[model samples]
Target: MLNKTASRSFYLNLWLGLVGLVVGIFAGFAVGISPALLLVAIVAVAGLIWFFASFEQAVIGLLILRSSLDLFSAQQLPAAFAIALNALTILYVLVALLTGKAVKIDKFWWFFALWIIFQSLWVILLPLGGLGMDASFLMSGVRVWLRYFSWLMVYLLVMQLKDNVPPEKIVSMLLLSLVAPISIALLQIFLPSSMLPSLLTSQGKAGSNVSGTLGFPNGLGIFLTMFIALVWWKLSISSKRLPWLLLLGLVSFVFVRTGYFTGLVAVLLLILFINSTKITPVRAIGVVLFCCAFLWMFASTEFGQQRLTEIYDTPLLNPNIDVSRSIILSYGDSNSFNWRIAHWTYLINAWSQFPILGYGLDTSPLLGIRDFNTGSGYAPHNDYIRFLVEQGVVGLTGFLCFLVGQGWYLVHLLRNSQSVNSRRNLCLILIALFVANIVSMLTSNIMDATTFFFYWWTLVAIAGWGNEYWRPNLATKSA
Candidate 1:
């Protein structure tokens, strides 16, 4: 009797399941299978994963995806990827808040939050207040706000994880994130352009310059500079240092190939600082090998030869050349050191018109895009000047405060943290990266959607994490 009842129930449930499947298929077909539906599905899945996964896992996955995204051009990927990233970030923050996690909010974070809020308000008000409210302009402003908010969310999420997650795990995740981009960059250099994705080629100009997977050489340079510093720092302290040294050499090779002068300067400064400390015989030999390999590659590669020529041949270095003439001439040619100087002048002049508040969020690019024909646009190339032009004095002040706050905090941490603690080494690495980024920003807009944002805020997140959980021990050591 029990068997007969069970068989009947199973058949009934199977029939209902079949009916539901048919209904779902009909519903999907009726919806016309648009991109929007696909996007919704993607978001749903990502949301579920974030909801179920541990915070550390979710963040690591996001960072890896973000690094992968750097390999493809923006047009190549669906908008859903970006949407999902933002949604997951928000979800993480909401969950943290709901779970009553002890979030570490410092003065720097408050300043940054204020800066974001200030910029976002202008983004909304500027469009309605005589900026014409065109959809394109408004959308551009919106995108800028989204980037800022996404960064904030990441920082907050990392802060929440400080007590729960191990520092080694976080560092490993960061190192792993670089593997894909570095590998792709190495491949691009050796493989013919025709064999690789056309989008990966620098501006679709064959053999022009390799941008790696970031689609922009300077962007790749910024990314490489940060990791190079981190790897070098790791090598300085680790007993098993060979792997770090090898990775450093690989990254340094790619960094030199990018031909970003500011990044080069940052790396040189990092080397000088690191060398100040005692070096073991092994590390010294590794450094010597890295230098030899770099020199050989630099001499052998066409791109490297051209970059060398450009660096040495710049007229700005000539004592005979008038500074004004050099600036004028270089600005005409584009992508020159003097050109950057001229660009800064133009942006500062423009900023004078609305120096108090400036234009608005993301407006600098719109204003500067007109100059794209000259091989450089209104990007201001310098993030400092870019912010000055867009946000003016008030916005610039807030940004500086946030930057200075971070720098001040890190310096304190370095002074107090125990020499033996891993956090101290990590703090030094973060300090070096922060300096490198600041240096790179002087010549390139390093705060954009590229690897810049990911690396920058990762530093911030780590710093925040350290400040919250690691300070007591550091304080004791200092005392």
Candidate 2:
């Protein structure tokens, strides 16, 4: 099944990476000036080769990569290098199958692959035939497209590797991988803002925002939400709860610092859902009271003050009324919101032209709309609006299926879960995160946020590890 394209690209990156490593070493040797970085490169190349030799290493190595490196940071990496990481991984999967690696991939994932290919082509070809994508746009979108595949690869890799490795070991390594991101975020807190690079401290003054290594507070907030859920699970299973509990508290403060309230809301929801099996009318009332107190506390934060004001200005937007240019929109126009209402309104009206089919994948932003004052183009802040306007109804439906389908599987697993104590913890955290992420997607650009989805898919892959209820339907009806 190896096509000519796949075969050619299969070993190309590995060979190239090795050659580059050799050339650099010789260049350093000939000059009699090998630096510490050259040594690091040598070790990294060795690690890359080791990853190539073992799927288990590749999966764990990728965890290290996602957590440690800034995936989209332009200053830290060449665009080609970042693409190569995932590109070579996909090629590795092809190599694995060709070499007869024995593993059973779930059928749902196979179908998901087909959808991604179809959608990618739709975007690529449409732009080629019409607007003719420039190099920057083309490259940016390719990275986005590759991430969809990386999600599948991580899932399949975990599913295959789980048979030999304890899920705890894998999860533990992943949690340990958080050291870099946490350290970087912590540096922004204690160190002076001027001490850090501007890219690392996107919030200007470091104390104002905790962008972390991910380089954006909003996306970092979403990523930490996952960490919070998982850390909660770790707290449940660990004999040494002090460490996990401390990590939980520190991470929560950083999440709050990010000023991305949507993530905060999601984490709250996750906590509530973890109590779903025990919920009663009295508990429900207590939940409402607790939420009110939490929101009140949140409104005291700088970002929360802005958000609370916006909500207060509007109270509740009446569906029957049109307030596109009303007082609520006016309040949001001046701040970090930057008039999202006007942007969404304009985009929706434009989308009416091709409501069924959409403009094309990743083409919604090409509509050439801009803010008058800033004269800067705004990304579709809302993903649902972006999908509808760009990929249309069909694209939106397909996306909803991907998100909803995962939730459906998680819910089913929990409902029919076996008596394995460890498995219950995994189910609760995973399901909490799945539902929480969807809620966060409404305000921010979750689809384009590489760091968030990279970790999101990894979490999904490992969530079912070592669990009996996670088998494919063909294998058995239930655990």
**Model 1 Cα lDDT, one tens digit per residue, 239-347:** 6767976788788777777665567667666665555455767656755665566566555667666655655435556666555665667756553666666666667
Which pairs in model 1 have colliding backbones? 368-378
Summing lDDT over every window of 10 consecutive residues in candidate 1, give the lowest-scoring window: 470-479
TM-score of 2: 0.79
Residue-level lDDT for 115 in candidate 2:
68
Structural similarity to truth (TM-score) of each candidate: 0.80, 0.79
lDDT of 1 at 368: 46
Q: How far is 240's C-alpha from truth in model 2 (Å)? A: 3.5
Highest-scoring model, lDDT: 2
Off by over 4 Å in 2: 1-45, 53-55, 76-82, 127-140, 202-207, 279-297, 315-322, 327-338, 366-374, 466-479
Per residue, candidate 2 scores C-alpha lDDT tens digits across 52-157 of 6776777677666676566345654523444656566665666666555556566556766776786686447554643233434665556567667666665666
